[model samples]
Target: MPDKTEKDQTQVPFGELLRNFVIELIVYGILIAIYFYVALRFLANPLAALFGNNLAAYAVISLGLIVVQAVFLEFVTSLLFDYLGLHRLSSRPGKH
Candidate 1:
């Protein structure tokens, strides 16, 4: 009774989904810890100085840094997921 597209769509098991979520959470936590350590260790003084010297520049630069951090973390996480043999779950049908 189902069409080809409907038949091709498969549901991921709840337990597997939960497990993957937990794994990703743990990995992200670890990466974030490292990122914080590096940022504070290296960037604290420079950012502070910039903030004190120029408020507008500091705001723009800070925003840029946040974007860079997000992109870097995402890329690292994707690589980590692949290396750990975990494939990202997709909502689209037949597109794992």
Candidate 2:
């Protein structure tokens, strides 16, 4: 029976799914951490030295940097998925 066939399909364990999701979250967290570390460690001092002290300006600059970092992360993750051969199957050609 179709119902029996469907019922026989393998199911992912809940713990395995949770573990995968957690791992992905930790990976993304580390990426964000590296972004902030690089920003503060390498760029912040030079930027402050060049631009002078203005809290509002620094805040705006930091916000822009965060947005850029997030976009960069998305692109990097897409590349990684492709490189790892784990890119999700497409329903249509040239569509992610």
Candidate 3:
């Protein structure tokens, strides 16, 4: 029996890797952008109501919440995709 080695790992072409990376960035960017957009809107409405139409405070708090939510959601989503093997599968060569 032969021992498995780290060198046995398959290498992806640089061009393909760059292309796939760009695609992943586009996908994640769109999803995360939408998520934060909705989150900001949702947070702003209630803040406005609670603050008696004070737009400045509402904007500040809502922006803070949006930033936090975006970071947390993005981290969780990235981890979930990795754990589910989605990222790894996407980088593989297509079968003909």
Candidate 4:
């Protein structure tokens, strides 16, 4: 027989899970919207020119921009989640 510690036995309520999920979704949506707006507003002309001038450079730049966006969004989301006192669904017990 296996011993069940309190941590192992505990379960998150569905309501709390749903709430956290909703909050995360909303935050990500807003962040993505803002990111797109800023990217398009500032980089559109430059990227368009690059694309016209050099295909390889444009492709590399586009890929780099995507990576940057993903990292930035994830970083911001973590900060926001900490600030909002929300626990990540994927986080495991005893792990920061």
Candidate 5:
């Protein structure tokens, strides 16, 4: 005789789980592409203009700008997720 709970369970396909993971990865990749586009297109030129003819200073300034843009991108992505109703459990994984 089988247990009632066992009999009542419905099996979810592993393909669905794999597909979900893949889709999430794809979304993250798109976000990364956006980050780089914003960083280079909007950030680099102004930073270069600020430190004209100085390769070292321009590199350092651009690096700082990149960091700031990365943080800004993460915030925008989080806001987007919340707007889409996919609330994040934590900003940093495994911290909770």
Candidate 6:
């Protein structure tokens, strides 16, 4: 058996990495913006009513939406990265 070396692995160019980072930022921002837009326009009043003017409930709901937005962005960006080959497959040897 032969030992694999890190030097054998492929690397992306710095420019491509920077470009990908920018793209990721824009995508995440868009997702979060959509979340806030929908939550504020549609959910805020109804939730405020349901909780009877409790500010804490709105805070909790806002935090939950943030978490959900982050998770959704992560899932979507991961899929896009995989499809676009912006990142390497984790199943590759020595990736861990």
Per-model RMSD to reference: 4.8, 8.7, 8.9, 5.1, 9.8, 5.4
lDDT for residue 41 in candidate 3, whole number 0-100: 72
Candidate 5 lDDT by residue in tens digits, 1-96: 944332323343557545655665678789778866975678667766777778898878778867987798788767655554344322323322
TM-scores of all candidate predictions against the true structure: 0.66, 0.46, 0.45, 0.66, 0.42, 0.55
lDDT of each: 0.76, 0.63, 0.68, 0.75, 0.63, 0.72
Report residue 61 deviation for candidate 3 (angstroms).
12
How many residue pairs collide in each prediction?
A: 0, 0, 0, 0, 0, 0
Q: How many residue pairs of model 1 clash at the backbone?
A: 0
Superposition error at 8 for model 4 (Å): 2.6
Off by over 4 Å in 3: 1-5, 47-96
Candidate 1 lDDT over 1-96, as tens digits, reads 955554444566778777877887898898788878986679999988999999999999999988987898778888866654455454336634
Q: Candidate 4: misplaced stretches above 4 Å?
A: 1-10, 80-88, 91-96
Alpha-carbon lDDT of model 2? 0.63
The candidate, 2 or 4, that scores higher on lDDT is: 4
Superior candidate under lDDT, 3 versus 5: 3
User: Which has the higher TM-score value, candidate number 1 or candidate number 6?
Assistant: 1
Better of 1 and 3 by TM-score: 1
Which 10 consecutive residues of model 5 have the lowest summed lDDT? 87-96
- In candidate 4, position 10 carries an lDDT of 44
